[model samples]
Target chain A: MPTSNCSTRSASGLALRAVADTLPLCIAVIPWGILTGALAIQIGMSPLQAQLMSLLVFAGAAQLSGMTLIASAAPLGAIFASTFVISSRHLLYSVVFRQHVTQLSRSLKVIMAFILTDEMFAVSEAHTKRSGQFSALFALVSGFSFYVIWNVATLIGILIGDTFKDLDSLGLDFAIAATFIAMTFGELRRFPVFIAVLASGCLSVLLKPIFTDSYIVIAALAGMLAAYVLGQEGET
Target chain B: MWWAITGMALITFFNRYAFFADFVRYSPGAKVKRFLSYSSYAVLTAIWAPIVFSVDTQTGFTHAGADYLIGVSVAAALSLLRVPSIVVVLTSAAVFFGIRFVI
Candidate 1:
């Protein structure tokens, strides 16, 4: 009984820490959420539909791309294909996360996998590295908090869609870029990772015309190959 | 519309859950594991490079505005100095907005 109580207390503490760590990211998330909502309305989605998409699909980039395709009158199959391409990067995140979450039960793993996003992966990976342990409670708290904030922000955007028509010019989307830059800068300290980043960025730009949206997946694979080759050379 | 949303949701979830499924029992080797470890850096770079570099799909090269360039540089510098992520993000946002105003 005492052991279980102590574990619960520590879990709550970890959850609190996760919330604190994730709060700043909300500034970035809120703007994107609002923008996504406003754009969804502009593209003829009912408030309910937009909210449902945010609740169900729950991925910003994929949702945005899907909306663009839908606006262009793309078929449902095209939308599904583009969403798959846009979200292929998450496959990598799941693979990396699998190692850490082996201790979790199947149902918990399902929940964990559901909340797996770029921000979630970044925050949770940083936490595991810092604490030398991964707590499911911490990851869930970080993720579900983002989930609630994002959906709420989307609702706000839907409510004020007409009045907030100028949200695009405010450069709110840059917040996501800025946050990513902050995160990637830390990873660049490692030599092999630096090479990998360079490779990915270069290939992404170079292959954009040839590969279009699929370039993200291809370039990322090239980057990983670059890092692997460099690691083999003992340059890490 | 509902069909599209359902399809997107299922596909997105499947991508996230595929590796964790009960059927995926194969363990990766050490070298494969090391390669997988670089995935975050690789994927994040793949996502941001085009936006930051202004790699126009049509024209192939447009200048990334000074505001974005400078904002990202400041963020990278602060992150290198081991500043807190929150500070780095806010500073970069401020720098981005401040530059947009001036120019």
Candidate 2:
């Protein structure tokens, strides 16, 4: 019994440490969360819907894309497809850390997977590399902390969004484009990646009239294929 | 509403949980890894490209508007400069509204 008690206490301590480490990244998350909520409302989502998405989906890029599709009155299938493709990158994170999580119980694994986000993965991976150990508590704490911060910021945006009118006219949706563009810059220097971006961007524009909302999925797949083909050219 | 929310949530969790379970210890090969590494960038470009530029029936592909054109150009330039994402967002937003105000 004393062993159990000791472990519990240490777990809480580890959790607190995780929170402290992740606090700095929270500053970056706040504006993103707020912008998501604001864009949801601008695109005609109810405050409830926006907050619920932040809580449930918990994916900024997917939520933003979903709201954009919803605003355009896109079909439900397109929304699901976009969400799947956008979040598929999480699979890489899961694969990378799967070997370390085998000891955890199924339920605990479920919780861990639920909160597996890009930021959480980066912080936890860094900790593991630095300390030469993996703490489930640390990873969960980091993820849940971001989760809480993101939702709170989303609520704040929802409140502020309700008070404002003509958000669309202000070109606030440009934030979505800007955000994606900024994200794309990270890998643009790689030749294959650059070709992929160019292929996907040009294909989507040309196919827009035909595919409408679902064009994203088609173009993204084409982009991946382009990258794969170029990757065979011997460029690392 | 619940349908969209639940579907998205489930898909996201499924992706994260894909290889976590002991039963699914499948490791992707090098080629697959290389392919998936570019998914985020490809998907992001696909999402925004159509928004910032589009096809006109009479003309070829064209920028959506001068405001969006300038705003997205600023975003691309800043991103190339390795600016922080949040700053890129805010600065491009300012340019967006600034252009709208001027025109």
Candidate 3:
């Protein structure tokens, strides 16, 4: 039987509630979208290509990293490698969500998977974690709406193109750093995880400037392994 | 360029859909789950480190520059205080432009 505070709500109600839940986060993303769109045009990307990246990639970190690399004239392989490493976190996200959505139909599963971004997952997870109910309507409404909002933000950015110069000068890129740092700190609820994060941060710093193409991947794997090893030791 | 985008989309879709591919039934050990939980920090760490430390300049990969460091420090400070990410971004921008305008 259904239970919890969310059990009685209609899908649309839950959807609105989910949107409401994420309203502050969404407002924050608007400026980011505008900044990215403007950067894309600034970096010699066609307005169409910029918008297309927003449409297709749908991952801000990936898109920003991609645009930055392309702007720096990084090779194609390096660009792909960097973005791929940045996004590999989604692999874990898919794993975490799989058990919840397994009972749903394949199409819904596909949509759920497609629309799963960090913020959407964070907001929806807050609700579903309590109830464990993978309501299709709720998930769809939340994720799809986030998707629309991101696209609209990107469009606004594209429209505002090129008056801004030097993303670093604007310090807008710090938003991403802040977001990622929040994600890191959010997970550090345990004492031992501190060791894991420290290991990761140090390894990444040391590995930077060493491997041109795959430092991020190497450092991340090293960090995860450090955590896994230390965690196992701590448990034993 | 289109190929690059297409290839990336394929990689990402594969990841998002990978666990549901019938292979995810073999749940890993508790250690793996615990480890996966920290993957976010690890990944974010790797992504942030290079950007924060290795600031590119017209001359070379020399310094983090006042703007980048100031921006990062402001964002990091506000974030530590539990400000929202969007607000952190806005504050960083405001501070950056603010300082530049005065001096």
Candidate 4:
């Protein structure tokens, strides 16, 4: 009876985990959405433009970078270029997600592609690994939920941004950086992973001078290459 | 703005589609799977190292602020202790804010 109960609990837990995995991404979207709206207003973007960007792009990093560039009165080319550089990581997300998401319908896949962001990708990938089950429906539900919450939060932020003008002074911005660091560190439990991280750090530092704004992309490629070589050797 | 956003969306979609098409039609080789598994660390580290190390400077190496160092130390310790992620985040943020206020 105890063993049977344990199995039942495990099965339910797996299902719950699938649902709960998306919760973090959804919660995180709210703060970032608010930040985008507030920043857009502060930078003189009209509410319509701010909302449109949030609705369409659905990328926090690119939107933030683009807004910063716009505020600085950078040329359109420069703004686009900077946004591209910051968002290049999405390419990696798309590639990784594609492997598991391919069996999904074309329409569903297209929609997932639009809503894919760093947190959503991380949660989705982790869920896949943990559950050992691939349900495109789950992925769609998680991704779509996150996307909706994000836009709603942005709208809220735009509506009430004036009331929270002191958000920066409160240092809430640091939460974003801290959250990512915590998440990454939690995931790094093995030596190969640790070494890959170190390699990436070194490469980013080494390449910063030469690559300027594109150092992150260069570092990611170099780190992946190094880790791949090392991981292959370990397997052999 | 429309052109740039649309272009980016297209490129991103294509990149994602390539992976689905490639892996679905043919399983990725062991080497590629190994690479993908290990790639997360490199990608994340690459993103964060710059922020932590270059928080003060624009391009070159410089002294990371005490709060930054303390925050990371606390974070690393919590990670090593195998604390839950949410706890680590909240504690580290609290530590950073406390230090920032105290000194």
For candidate 3, the per-residue lDDT at B53 reads: 70
Order of quality (DockQ): 1, 4, 2, 3
**Considering TM-score, which of the candidate structures 2 and 4 is the better prediction for this target?**
4
- After superposition, the stretches of candidate 4 with alpha carbons farther than 4 Å from their true spots are A1-19, A22-31, A72-77, A135-138, A160-170, A205-212, A233-236, B1-27, B55-60
lDDT string for model 3 (A34-137, tens) is 87898888888787888888787888767877888888987888777777776676777787677677787888788888888777765565566446665657
> Model 2 off-target regions past 4 Å?
A1-50, A59-112, A116-146, A157-165, B1-8
> How does model 1 score by TM-score?
0.93
Residues A46-66, model 2: lDDT tens digits: 889889999989988789888
**Candidate 4 lDDT by residue in tens digits, B16-95:** 45555534455656666767665556666676676566522555566357787788788778867767656776788789
Error of 4 at A221 (Å): 1.6
TM-score of 3: 0.72
* Model 3 chain A worst lDDT window (10 residues): A166-175
Residue pairs in candidate 4 whose N, alpha carbon or C atoms collide under 3 angstroms: none
**Candidate 2 global TM-score:** 0.67
lDDT of 3: 0.69
Residue A143's lDDT in candidate 1: 90
Docking class for model 4 is acceptable
Off by over 4 Å in 1: A1-6, A234-236, B56-62
Please list the C-alpha lDDT of all candidates, in the order they appear: 0.84, 0.80, 0.69, 0.68
User: How many angstroms is residue A21 displaced in model 1 relative to the true structure, after the best TM-score fit?
Assistant: 2.6
Inter-residue clash pairs, candidate 1: none
TM-score of each: 0.93, 0.67, 0.72, 0.79
